[model samples]
Target: MSLISLLIALGAERHLSSPIWQFNFYYQHYLRLFNRISWINSSKSSASDNDGETATSSVIANTLFIAIPVVACYLIIEALDNSLLYLIVSTLVLIVCFGCIQTRNCYKQYLLAAFRGEPTTCELHHLQLLQDKNLMDMGFGQSLVWLNYRYFIAIMIFFVLFGAPGALAYRLLTKITEQNNTAVESDDIGSDLNKDVAADIQRSELPHAHNQAISVFSQKILFWLDWLPVRAVAFCYMLVGHFSKAMPVWLDDVFNIEKLPHVLLVDVAEASEDFMIEQGDCTAEPCLLVRLAKRTLLLCLAVIALLILTGVLS
Candidate 1:
């Protein structure tokens, strides 16, 4: 059932490439409502409490916000109590949860700009992407590689191991962090839908100080949540790419918690594939890295299918 869901979801993702299908449609509305309720309920305590108390309250509210949907998802799946129904619902959730449509579109535009020799446009797109993903400077190819892991591969890994609920939890956490990423254009990628969402969120928002607890907790918890899967995907990179080149870098950072997941993936992915990055040009390298990441994804799925075939997983 899991393997079947994976295949179906991937197929649907390619065909159903509309903004209406994106999870942000529901997330934006859910968050705005939650924010209002949380603010209203905590108005007095927040006014009376110290900074520590307010921060603690913020963390609690954020956790409850993330937990509500995840718990509901789990309960719904359990209540179904039938295999076909489980597969159908999980497949639907996976389709909605999967993909980085905005990022993917922006990447295509970036490539077109790069190919057209419009360095200025490429630079602007690059900066916006870095801002959206909250990443530091890395090669364009490396950025694509890491985003592939973050937006698609990581979610798939969690889905296989835990279920749709796990995938939804991870994605929900990301959306919250991405929401608080920047005050103005915090949209994960520049979707008009997301722009409107960000505008609404900011206008009704409290001060940055109020959201500090959520930002801190979400980043810290997201790191731990991503730790295992990041390594898991890195191993796949090693298997599908140059094992000899990637293995040492993988070991060096395997146990290092301080290294962010994207940084680790970028480093390992760079070693896994060979390419020459021109001084200012970001064209060919991104294609290579994206291809390497795709191969790793296929290898990851193959292993999952093998395990299921051997009755090691169900």
Candidate 2:
């Protein structure tokens, strides 16, 4: 069932240039609901607690928010008596959980700008995309590798391991983490504005302590979620790329599973950085990174197919 759903989702994605699930499909609705709840519950201001307390509370709140929907979906799928309907619903859920539509679109635009000799415009767009993925610290070339891991491989592995609920949980965690990172970046901007603006206009609507704690906890949870899958995908990279060059770093970083996926992937991916366009001086790193990632993805698909054929995964 996992293999079948995966094949269907990939097929659907190939035909649709835009992801069937919009970039903000989940986040937009979630934010609206969250704001509504906050408004109704404004009398309770416990969110402004101590750093540790706020962080713990925020983590629990966010985890419950994500897990509720995942459990509901799993229960709904299990309750279905019609096998055909079950397959269709499961396939659609996987499709929605998979793909980084906004990321891919921006990448295409970045490549177009680069090809047109607009380095300034390309770099701006690249930075914007990196910020959206909360990967600005990774730099452009390394961001490409990490994006593949976060948006594709990690989600794929979760689906294969624990089915739709796992995939949904992974996607929700990623979306919420990205949102928190954006908020954290805004807090930095707010600090600069606080220096320049009137005292009344300076203070942010969101409490600093509260927001900071949320960001800290969100980042930690995202790291834990990606730890296992990131290593699994890194191993896939070594298999498809120059193994000798990639393996030593992989071995070293395998112990530090708590580190951000970007740190580990960047070190290893840079080892396979031999691709270059001889005729043009345009950045070919993104292209090469994408090729390497796709090769790893193809190898993953082949493995899944073999497992299905042997009745190891049905």
Candidate 3:
């Protein structure tokens, strides 16, 4: 069932871009409903309330807001058992969890713009596709690596661990973080960005405490959820990319809590490309990076296939 659902989702990506395949649309609905019930925005008007109490309340409220619906959906799916409806419902849930159709299309367009030697145009296209304008500084290739890790690899890891419910939960957690961060940034209207989002990517900067405006509790939870799966992704880069170079970076940063996930991913991806440029005209670097990411995805699928063959994945 995992393989079938993955194949169906990938097939939809390859051959279709219909509104029915828009995961963001469905995800937004879920987010809206969750936000309405979340205590994340609750005021601390009570004089007796302290910081610890407020933080704890926010965490519990956010957790329950997202958890109840996901648990209910998982129970319904489980109750279907071996019915044909099980496959259909599970497939649909998996598809929505996989990602939005429009996002992938926008990424493809960004690549096309990159290939045309239009750096400015590429940046514009990328800004349109990604929620953070600061991410554009990573270049198209590195940005692709970051998004692929977040929206694809990480989500799949949770799916394998806890099925469809896990997948939805991970994506929702990401959405909630982004939404909260965006809201915080908007409120601090006078906050200067330093115009170094791209420059910071180049440095592979540490994940600073000051930059976090989102709930620290939720961020910690996401970091724990991402820890193992991200290592798996880095290992995939080593296997399919430059093994010697990629391995050291992977080993060094695998335990480093300060390093951001996307920065680590982009570092390995940048090193993994087997570019064949003769005169250093590396116009194909962005596309090649994307290809390497796809290869890594295929490698992961192959391993899952092997596990299934050995009667281990079922």
Candidate 4:
């Protein structure tokens, strides 16, 4: 299934402008509906002095929402290879039917507003009117909305159907090995040696040196994982924005032009910076790290979906 998702994602990447309008439309619709409902439920419960119960109910409702999508995804996976043509045709029809309604100018305006860093107070207020709590609850609702729509539901479906143990294993192994290596390196450099000797050892074992190694390993994994989907993201950005604007930023931020083939150092540096920024600005609306994480997540979901589809078809 993972392989199938990867292939589909890669194939999609080749034709970056392929209209996923339908898919995006339906997805956004469900997301908005789920979020609105969750917000209302949470607000009503919270206002009635049953905060705990409300929270619990909200969680359960969220769980149900999540479950439905996961089941739908699994069904899609089951139908993949057995009905390749049917799957393709169905997906296309879905895209077209949903896309027509979802591809409205108003939605594009909202997207542009997001990109341009405009406040979504109006949208938040509208959602709030449907409930009692304010925008903060709405924000939480949105997070819960994507938690199912984008991450757990999408990725789980792909991983379960495709057996993407390679990707999973690679991520796990690299993380574990990197942590062990860092501990060892830190221990080696922190011993009671003379200042000059310690400096020499530290030079040989720069703090970032271990990080660099881990970064390299991660990059390698992404290299394998990104064979198809990275381009898809790049293309999506291009279609929404302009090629020059989107591609250059993506190349510099995601591809790491300065580091190029060496993805680890760049990733580490970016990750570190992201952490610092998030910690510094706790109240900022969706910190840079969150945005990057979301993009990575979306990319992963797309890949996983493709893999599941491929596995079923094959």
Per-residue lDDT of model 3, residues 117-199, tens digit only: 67677668666545542343566667777777777777766776678888888887776665543322221122232123223
* Collision pairs in model 1: none
RMSD of each: 2.8, 6.1, 8.2, 21.0
In model 2, pairs of residues that clash are 1-314
Error of 2 at 55 (Å): 2.5
For all candidates in order, the CA lDDT equals 0.80, 0.70, 0.65, 0.37
> Which candidate gets the maximum lDDT versus the true structure?
1
Task: Compose the digit string of candidate 2's lDDT tens values, residues 153-244.
Answer: 77777787777888888888777767654532222123443333323222323466655666777778778877877777788888888899
Model 4 accuracy (lDDT, Cα): 0.37
TM-score of each: 0.90, 0.84, 0.77, 0.30
Full ranking by lDDT: 1, 2, 3, 4
The global Cα lDDT (0 to 1) of model 1 is: 0.80
Q: Order of all candidates by TM-score, from best down to worst?
A: 1, 2, 3, 4
> Could you give candidate 1's per-residue lDDT for residues 1-314 as a string of tens digits?
98999999987897876655677667776766775675645652563356657677667777788899999999999999888999999999999898867688789999999889998998788887777766678867778887787778888878988899999998988877776764433334346756666666665556566677678889899899889889989988988889999999999999998999888888888899977878877687888888998999888889888998899987
Comparing 1 and 2 on lDDT, the stronger one: 1
TM-score of 3: 0.77
